[model samples]
Target: MRRSPWATLTVLALAQFIVVLDVTIVNVALPRIQTDLDFTADGLQWVISAYTLVFGGFLLLGGRAADLLGSRRVFLTGLALFGVTLLVAGLAGTPGALIAARAVQGLGGALMSPAALSILTVTFAHGRQRNIAMGVWGGLAGLGGTLGVVAGGLLVDSLSWRWVFFVNVPVVVALIAATPLIIRAVARRSGHGFDLLGSVLSTAGLLALVYGVVRAEPVGWGSAEVVGCLAAGVVLLAAFVAVEARSAAPLVPLRLFRSRALSSSSGALALNGASFLAMFFLTAIYLQQVRGASALRTGMEILPMGAAAILVAVVTPPLVHRFGTRTVQLCGAALSALSLLLLAGTGADSGYASHLLPGLILFGAGVIAVGVPAQIAAVVDVEHHEAGAASGVVTAFYQVGGALGLALATTLSVSRSHAALADGMAQQQALVEGFHRGLLVAAAFAVVNVVVTLASPRIAPSAEQIAEAAATA
Candidate 1:
């Protein structure tokens, strides 16, 4: 890189942090947004769901375009789009305008994220530098969630909730302008013809799938809209797989799945994502509603989890070097399950220190253990041309997993809460009962991860062994 490689990484890392931050930031500001826009309780969720649906749906397409069209160009375009819509969202006076803006923001995120990851992967050679980059990338993802909650609470309390939307402008503008100066551009390679049909099927299919999952909580799975969406999603996705298998220049190269490293990493990421989201959703509710903590205080309590994840992220490269990717991933899964089981013990009267903190720390460390190495495994074998698409697949699994996990947890928790209420438990106590059940389900997912990690063969070679083999070969 003509510019310092670290400079390129810093800019890309900042951009990604902003992207992930938006995912959770608006949550703290939801009440303010609802009141300001006069949004019905039923309609308010669309603000968040719209972003996730579009972001998850089009990610693969975005990643493919980055590889074929040009990662630098795609990254800049997406960043610009996100910045523009962010301003529009901040200025929006009506519910429709804000919701529409949020959807567009998701599009920008879809376009930007994989391109950024692809760029990062190529910027540093695949070794210690690459591992460091992955650690930063993964760590930023963890930090972003905590920052979102804390920053959102501060911004909303000190200023208007609109600041949550407005805050992206400076960071994005800087990245966009710095792109040419700091980031080296990669030469474009010849690609197979664009698979338009596959693209449409994949994008539409994912959108429908995520939309269905998102709606399941509010409307129930039996609702016509939900059932129709879920069925159509399944069919369209099946069609997408078929198209990819046949297409010469498929958006997602089916052959990539031939790499156990990439495929298994993707699966593990999905499970980790499920556990992560379930923990976030359940714990937040437990703090705010059951424990009567303020939004800022809850954010404060969650800060340690982020801190722990970051700490693990820093040490993970060495751990992988000594232990290998499979071992790190397996141990992480085990830790995550243990953490969830700890959390499952939470009661209506439980204190954060006595109960939540131990679980949160373990969960955070476990996520880093799971996420950083899985990320390394995902793209370790990738050629430059496939980096973007591979990144997209990993990202897609995470988004889908999070949506599915959250839906499952919410359904289980709500049902349990209802049962408790019917059995004459107080509202608060009933809510706690439901939360406990939901947590156990979350714990179960982590345990399942343990089984899968144990059963699945090692996806990638040990770090030093791969380096040595590459040298000899």
Candidate 2:
């Protein structure tokens, strides 16, 4: 049976929503989870970090699996794993068990996210339809993080924090049931063998990299464990690259990076993710700790950010049609940096309506503008067969960048706060100063992206180029 492209998108979007939602849903519930699970202060961070580490680590494998095994098969398999793990996490009685469940849940997300994206890339032809589809995907991705906060607060306030994990179970079940009916499966491509060595090297390398970066926040960056993990990650990833350069069947095709559009988009997306996620972390802390707002109220306050992102997602494609993608990306990056600069101006007594709303709204709009184009550019010119690999590269960049950003921001924030306390500043004032420093780091990332965007080729591939590339493939 033929399925409407819209129906296919709906199913994919819902699956992705839960995947992205899990990234930040636990933020507001962290304290509750710690209390209930008796998590040590240092151990509590893993509930969030475990998911991030595994999710970022396994994305490349998942994307390649979709290419070799079939996107629909990988998507469904991931969905099932994700659903089961969410159930286990919700019911977990011990801290270790919950963290274990979260780690497996990250694995499921790693598989589902890129597979769904590959499906979308192939389903819609390039041009207006593809832009609109990616716009929706980009918007949903941004909205998921924002909604996670809102949903987390509501669930934790009215129910237990366990509901944060449980809430997605029903959605997962629905997506599993609905997917096959709407989207037909493609047969796996022949003539391509799985690259086992590349898979192991890339996955282990990414896992080590993420683990080191996330761990650096709690442990000093100078610690032996951090230094060892970072060194191992770099060496392993370098080896993975060398292996791919020689392999007949590479896990990630080196040729893909030759496309200036895809390469630039990957880099820009990393900086974009870094800025956006770090900003969220900084603002969330500012709301709860500085203003002393309830979780529910903080979520409500952040609602406008999502609204602005949706608005930009809807409007950006047309702007790209007229102004060109590079223009819009530059403007978006500028706005994002400006938003963070504005946010950095917030004092200990700053009011939400007067001080914070402008930046929040601009951030929402800015991130979507940059993200929608980056998302489109990453897969738009790639051959259909390599769409999964292209998707994985960009998605991996964003996830890894987000993890790095959060870690850096947390370390900077804590260090600044402690320094201020040493100088005998009031606790509230010192905390706000630390948040300011973190916001500046986020703003710096966006500013750096501006330079990155300026240095890259044009955002959209020309029609002639796309055709020639397609013919070449």
Candidate 3:
């Protein structure tokens, strides 16, 4: 008896949901974790940054592993690692221990995310079903991020902060049990040896680059540590590309980017991620600092945005099918820009119902609209053999983009606030002005994505591409 495809999708989606949820869920619990574990104010940030850095760093390697070692093998291995790390993190008595666990969890996430996506790409035919699946996948990705705030607040308020980590344990256990029943195992690919040099270069380069970027705002970007890391990362990545071009069994085949759809999708996803995360970051500040909302209240306020995203996610696939991918994506980009513009227009006296709610709703709708189509486009042209690598590439772009965007927003917002204060402006007025500037920066990112989307070749599948996609399924 064969398992239903939807069942397989459910298992995969749940794995992805937890992976993404973990990224943000720990945020609300950070203060509690710090209090309990005696973390230094500086050390406390590692709780979030450790996971992000490792997850982004190893994604490429994880994806390629799925291709060579078999998705089922990698997926299960990642799930087990993730589950054990959750336990360790929850029980950790010191900051170092918790940070270490979080770092390892990031590695597990790196493995699980790409493997699950690779499976999805091959599981469904590239048509309406695939589009719908991508929408659900994209929606859940956004939803997980949003819900993390709410769930963390509720859990930390009612129970202990450890519950944030503990809550996912049962879900992971269930997924591990269901995975073998639903997803059939495949033999590992033969004749293709791992590209150890490329993997080392790519991983080191990404880790350094992400570390530098994340540290830039806290420690000046021009500081020796950040500069050295950025320089080293760029040099190492360049070497990695050179090595990949010549390697017979390259970790990431250089040829994958030749497809207009794949390349454009990668760029578009980066900008989309930049705008989305920047918007979230700036809005959180606006609510908490400007409006004097509590952490729990802030999460509750953002609920409408999540609701809007869910609605748009359901409708976006059909919109893509009807209006075509480019048109739909352009529309999404437009909505994102409009949302940012609305946010930029907000002032200290603006009311949530009148000023914030509408912008948040549009943002929720806009991001999903752009993301689902862009995600679908990313893999539509790739061969099944390289699907994992392709998935890894696009996902990596989104993560890195978010990190870069948030860093930029923080730096600019702070700089602007300081400048205003130096000019004798009131602190509240200075902060609001700084936030407005940050919102515009996010809007600029959205506008850039619109141009990139418009310039790319349309993603309508050719008959040959459609046939290839069908064969993959």
Q: Number of the top candidate by TM-score?
A: 2
How does model 2 score by TM-score? 0.86
Ranking by TM-score: 2, 1, 3
Residues 36-143, model 3: lDDT tens digits: 899743345467656765676677778768878998989999999999999999999988899899989988997888788778877887777886676577667777
Give Cα distance to truth, residue 91, candidate 2, Å. Answer: 3.2
Candidate 1: C-alpha lDDT: 0.78
What TM-score do all the candidates reach, one by one?
A: 0.85, 0.86, 0.83
Candidate 2 lDDT by residue in tens digits, 1-473: 78899999999888877787887677777767777889753355567666765777677777778878999999999999999999999999999999899889988988898788778878888767776676577567767977888998898889998999999999999999999999878667665676778767876786676667656756868899999999999999999999999998777789999888788888899899889777886676678778887777777888898889878877876676566668888999999999999999988778788989999999999998888667666776677656656767777788767766766666677678878989999998998988999999999999999998887666555543333222211
Model 2, 15: alpha-carbon shift in Å? 1.9
Query: lDDT per model, in order?
Result: 0.78, 0.80, 0.79
Best by lDDT: 2
Clashes of each: 0, 0, 0
Model 2: worst 10 consecutive residues (lDDT sum): 464-473
Model 3 lDDT at residue 163: 89
State, as a TM-score between 0 and 1, how close model 3 is to the true structure. Answer: 0.83
